[model samples]
Target: MNVAPVTPPRPLDVAAVFPQLVPLARTATRLHPRPGAPTWYDSSIGGPLLWPADEPWPHCEGPHEVDGMNPVLSPADVRLERRIRAASHGREMTPQEQKTLERIRPPRKLPMRPAVQPYDGSMAMLPVAQLYARDVPDLRAPKGTDLLQVLWCPFDHPIMPRTALFWRSAATVTDILGTPPEPPAMQFDAYLPEPCLLHPEQITEYPDHLELSTELQEQLSQWSVPQADEEDMDPQTYYDCVLSNAPGWKVGGWAAWDSTDPCPRPCPECGTGMEVLLTIATFEEGDDEGRSWSPYENPAAEPSPGSDHFDPGRPTAVQIGRGHRQHLYICPAAPEHPHLELMT
Candidate 1:
């Protein structure tokens, strides 16, 4: 895929507006992943990784709850349903038409047991995403590691899917695993991420309003006090454009603490502080303010529903509770140490 450089929106000079905030500016890289089938060499979601064939594949052993009524339909069945809906085009369905469609495409019946049964005596893990430092410039791996592979069980574990992170050197994997096992059924379509190629664009970012101190926040809200050439400029609009954090899937940006306060995440192996490595966001922007982070080129093009560009926020189609975000944290001191996940 031809990756174009992002054309960032022209933001108000906040530092010029308020000199006190000059030191708060930070750079972040947005990994804009579009739908595609990526190879082992490409940085992508639901793509193959450079895994050694000798190593054991990761799997989750769980007693997951089964939804017997909700069945996993085959790809063919899904396509047929789509064709039927398209043909109908919202027109009322006649009894004969409905009966014929029902007979051809019956309601799906999902398995009563978990997607992958524990003690099945096999490594039944499914690949989620794979990233190479060469492809994703913002990936922070250990000195010897350049590859990051993420996998998870198809079934949910409590509130979210159970995930595992593996960091390795691409050169060390001489014997690669050509094929891997997949779960019999996935609980949700969102869980199945479509393959997407990354177009990493570096941009400036700032702390979310929630991260700022009460006093500093109050100072920002008092836009009326500041003398400006544009009398129509709203203080709140300026704050949203220049002061707030840019949204979307990014690296090395401040956490979005809109729902809750910042909770200190410490490494389990070492008590050292863990930093945010990657943010798996549901939508590129939660609100209008997030539009500041939209790609520079064609920023105003609105994608229609069901189009490839539809749901600009969820390019990867990976959702965590109605379009919330999942933050992946790694130990700064020991990059190889186990990572942690927080869904917010």
Candidate 2:
């Protein structure tokens, strides 16, 4: 079993400092996804899914953005390049390796694969995550469903890969797909997520001030910073970054609203307010690894050998829109309702 760290106490008692904010508290499950071999049975990020063999694999019929410049590269091509890129760290790339990269840079006619169930032009979606309700504490599902599988078209749906959601009963998936189909070509390398097992940690959170009412926002802005050293800094900034949202992959939490101001994200099927189902994050924590939302680990424990030396916060190797987050929002009233997607 993979070892998961425990999140230490918050820098200050937010509730005690601001009693009125008590009602705003929401529980979020921080899915600390780390590099590991996760099977279909596991709740994981970028791991092989528990997809049924008989059912057709999901594909994004993107009305996809076609920028005539960069050639769409196959999943294998991107994976090969990532491997080379990772190996080249701390050392110069070999002449052959450099040449290989240069060759793949240009657009070339990709050979078609043997028809897998007579494929149409729609690109095969990449597996983004698979969450078993048992593993993720906050993953509520529709009736008779306990598993959630997420997939995304490897091409950009404007800014990021468009996601599709599926929820099913684990017991019903008798014949699991041994190998799933891959997109013939993907637009960006970051769209593909490296397999990582999850360590879901539940924590309480409040909404970013941007999501609060005007009166509350004004009140929060005037409140004093709880930390003595941070007194000079803006109180709203301190609360938003430190006291509010817990970073990394999480479920059922408030939106940070960092990229754009908070906006209406109502479910299309039924105009109900949507709830955060899953948050696919870029970095695990804030500026200081040991501070803010980062977990506190045993100081004497030695670093494990053979761990991927990629971005420490990015064990999954998935970078969303220049190190931001992508959230999947489901209807709280009816989870089966069409979900909402946002990048922040």
Candidate 3:
């Protein structure tokens, strides 16, 4: 079913070269999400959650500001558009398909639904991910919890969509929700994720060199990749891109804070430090993103450039601000404490 290898291939034994990095190793679950029709019981991205039917669906009470860039469209419209695009790829659309397209996106008008009022109303949240602890070995859930459900408002709260976290006992959810509520209209179509099944692979990760101690950072700068081609790259740059925090969808690993690498995200309620719970990323890695970071066992299976097919790199099709990452941090002191969201 396209599950990724647990031990992803790496060019160099990083820890062998950098002995000091051994103790810094932290296990992270790489959720290699590939497009599939996932059911409620499956651990998936943009899939149905194993939610109790009686529980009220979460909604975002927002004062949403619509930038001209976002053209509001209903979830149904988005799905239809996707289907039309896929069906017509590399071929001319049938007359009926063209008519259906026009019905969804009529000339000189925007797609909208009468019931949507996100400008000053509560909008039902869309499922971002649903992870069962059994599927993700690195999922550090609360004592009574075995499932983690993530949902997000389709409208941008600041620059990125706001997300909510829910932890529950899978056994307690006796009756599954037949159909959860969807927002009448969403600001951006990218907010609607393509359903993807997870191939959770546990891997070790170290903090970004920028997030390391000054001494460790200094030490790293002196060690470049032994490879002939990468020898030209700076030592720290190689480590940061190839050996440090992995990219794409993952749980409980170092966050790629890039320019905003303060790294000390303390809990708002308690003084205890926060930990990264999830990272919703735009693109999965390829050879271009460094061989070490990519989870693909076969290089040829990677998405080819200029192809009119589904790009595996963007299987979920969820993009944060300007193609950045949306990281959710939970309080280490108490999982129930309000989670924090950051875009980087």
Candidate 4:
């Protein structure tokens, strides 16, 4: 089912407050994905991609160690656990409930030796996300290409889930490969994304606080606020409400560099600066109301009573350090040039 576009919250007019920021706006498209199966031509997460039959499918050759155990739980077990938790909210679990809980979440066995072991060469790469230029206007594929496909190994590299990028023309793919190889095992459930269609919504964005110069920072801090009849507003609050970094998954928006200083990665093949192609985020919105970039047409609409915790940002079921975003950058000069991934 097609959902309505999310209405982006009105950001504070920083340019009007600080004239220097007028030229800093950039367009971003939020690709909202939900859980379902997708076709080759559709924009989806963890879905079959349009590819030539002759092209070799990508796979991860690991000496891969089982980074962690990801227990597969049945939906019935999940429902039962939820019921037990809901019923026992304010009271201790009854003996029967305790036994059921124990059975639901059995103790996991620890590896006999050091967990670091070589990959047995059985893991296969899985499709992560696919986007067509027709769906996302901001997708920066090569001159002749109209599609971007991302695949990653299920296990983590030293840098965590390593990904590969492919750019191609949808028109050129006359023979689509029907069956793709699947990963034998996944280290975490978060690594597996339920297929979702994209409801791409375009919006304008500004640079994060760290990107601002010291003078601009001071100006932001010292700007005089118009006094309301009752109270005065803090300039810092204005900045936070308007000028702070945009959170969650986005395309062509400013990078959320909360963990460290800005590290501009250069293209290995060419000297051109790489641009952010996509940001895989953990949550759609944080506690800050200003960062609520929901694409729903009506922002005030409430979710179903029991589904209030539904998070749009985690649609892909992918997470980085402490739920930080994984930023993928591409060379501006050449779209097919090797891409870079950074988790912040």
Candidate 5:
């Protein structure tokens, strides 16, 4: 019989963990702020928040669905709808007009979940959550209308949960506004504000203001600086850029296509299935690594050492924007097929 070996206790650093625990700890430490803590009132009408003068507004960088609907439901459409209604001159809507408006009414009920099968192809008796959203009129009528109502079920997957929630929410607005639906877009840094969890008495406002999480606030702060675009900036520094803005993970756009598969036909320019060649992903200063630097709008000027280069080949250095991107790499072998067909 062997005796059990003793295990050493692991060391913990309270100091290192302090920063991570502070925000939540602060919220729990105080039962509540005094009657007048800091009241943040949103009165931007229907427009975007003015954003703090010292801070930059966050731009969507992650994968997201771009709508392809004609007569698309957009912020601008909200204005057009009002104009059309105003031009009617107080005349009551005809049956056709009534139907038109009714068709645009947002969804109210939660969507049904598909039946799932266990080992025997039957769903477990677990509860499922459904999500829904709708639209409402603006108080001032024209500045903006409230994109009303969103519901989320508890059963939703946590990974990329916001994508589904946001899509369902936006879809309701799109349907009621007579907008054709677009596939969902997913981006790394983009996010919807977290909903407030409060009792009816605790919250006076019927509609709560969307609050960005402290972590998200910090991310937006980092992304806001114009200097971050500098070529000298670390390539890894912009890794968030690729995560937030590139289109491959979802669908659509040139980035969505898969170049690795063998092409059925030859390339468009060379009449051969274009081979995937390793090229340097280089950043030029002032957006002009190749062309003569323009005086009108020079965004960047020199390549920074912080930039990381990805090479399928063993090349340490290569020219960017030369034959690397379009002619040698991006073209299709077959004339019949679109070069940039997105891989699902």
Candidate 6:
């Protein structure tokens, strides 16, 4: 009797794999901290709520859990907590304690994502992805191969909605596979406003044709089978294309109205053309969709429901008047205060 021989599974490429592992160790920031007041980071549900160590956080009940890791902190989360506790007790942390605290504390990042470009005629809930290059030594990677891909998830940004943190394919994956004969995009109809746990295997494929741009068309045209230098390509462009066709604003917080004459143009960061997810006219509709509404909507409308007077001191929403493209941008300089205008 002939027996089939079992081949050993390929060895874990330790040298090639360690480079990717470093990213997991980088401390992740809580975009919506439990103890902070409301901001765009709280765009999801009832807005940001205080998460005091003395009390429990509000829990969501459903088929999938929205509440984060149980108790006050995970093992990894404890290091940062201890540091703050020690400081509050009026004691200096030891050198070892300091190092561990740094490893667990969130890194400082610029406020992005919510950036608006009136000139580009677009509004973005968040910067889709920020790319950084790192070096890796691979046993199989040719001696000259050095750069590796480091793509950040959009929901990781504090200002973006928790629901927006869906899985996105790596740009390098496409570079290696080449553009599929039929590239797919996520179905707009499939996205849910609420957050849910998703498994890696459950990822969906979307078509590449929903919203197209001339630059994107040119890039897609140039993709040939088995191409080199695929690692450096920008895959976010493909996402921007798909989002351009999204049925409606997925999250609601702030809306911009450009001073241009005719209509608000789509944001270059978000829309293919001049994309306005909401106008002053639609601010009320967005407020109805989520807890946030524009202060400009009813200058007389209360900041929070049931308040006696509107916080006229709060920033105004960008008015989308008739225009080709406003040169203004969502002010990155003032994340807490985002309004429509130029990129400057």
Q: Which candidate number maximizes TM-score?
A: 3
| Candidate 4 overall lDDT versus native | 0.69
Could you estimate the TM-score for every candidate? 0.77, 0.87, 0.88, 0.79, 0.18, 0.17
lDDT against the true structure, per candidate, is 0.66, 0.78, 0.79, 0.69, 0.22, 0.23
Q: Write the per-residue lDDT of candidate 1 for residues 1-344, one digit (tens) a residue.
A: 33353836644666676666668776767777665567878887766777899998786676554454455533234334544554566598767668756865466665444554433322356677787888666677788989988887655666667788899999999998898666655655566665566777776666765567788788777863352224345555456544456666777666776456677789999989887777777776535443545665533244323423234556676777677777788898997788887776
Model 3 lDDT per residue over 54-105, tens place: 9999998886766543356889998988888886877999999999888876
TM-score, predicted candidate 5 vs. hidden true structure: 0.18
TM-score of predicted structure 3: 0.88
What TM-score should be assigned to candidate 4?
Answer: 0.79
Total backbone clashes of model 1? 4
Instruction: Give candidate 6 regions above 4 Å deviation.
Output: 1-36, 39-47, 50-96, 99-249, 252-344
RMSD of 3: 4.2
* Global local distance difference test of model 3: 0.79
Residue 172 of model 6 has an lDDT of 24
What tens digits encode model 6's per-residue C-alpha lDDT throughout 1-344? 31211212211222132232222221111111011123222222122211223322222121121112211123224424433553544577778766665655445455532332112111122111111112111101112422211111112112212121111222322223221111011111111111111000111112222223466445544542112133232343322222111111111112221231234434445443321111112012211222221111232332333221122221111111221111222222221122333210
lDDT winner = 3
Would you list the clashing residue pairs of candidate 4?
Answer: 5-295, 5-296, 5-297, 6-295, 6-296, 7-295, 7-296, 63-118, 63-119, 64-119
lDDT of candidate 2 over 100-180, digit per residue (tens): 887777544556333322224789899999999998888888889999999998776677779999999999989999999
Candidate 4: list runs displaced more than 4 Å: 1-3, 68-106, 110-115, 224-245, 287-291, 298-313
TM-score of 6: 0.17
Tens digits of per-residue lDDT, candidate 4, 1-344, equal 43555745654566777777778777888776654457887998767899789898998887566643444344345446656775676799999998997887667776644445454766667787899988887787788888888888867776568888988888999988888777765655466655565667777677776678899888777663542111244445545434544566677777876667787689999878988898887766643443445555533243223321224556555667677778899888987888888887
- Ten residues in sequence with the least summed lDDT for candidate 6: 196-205
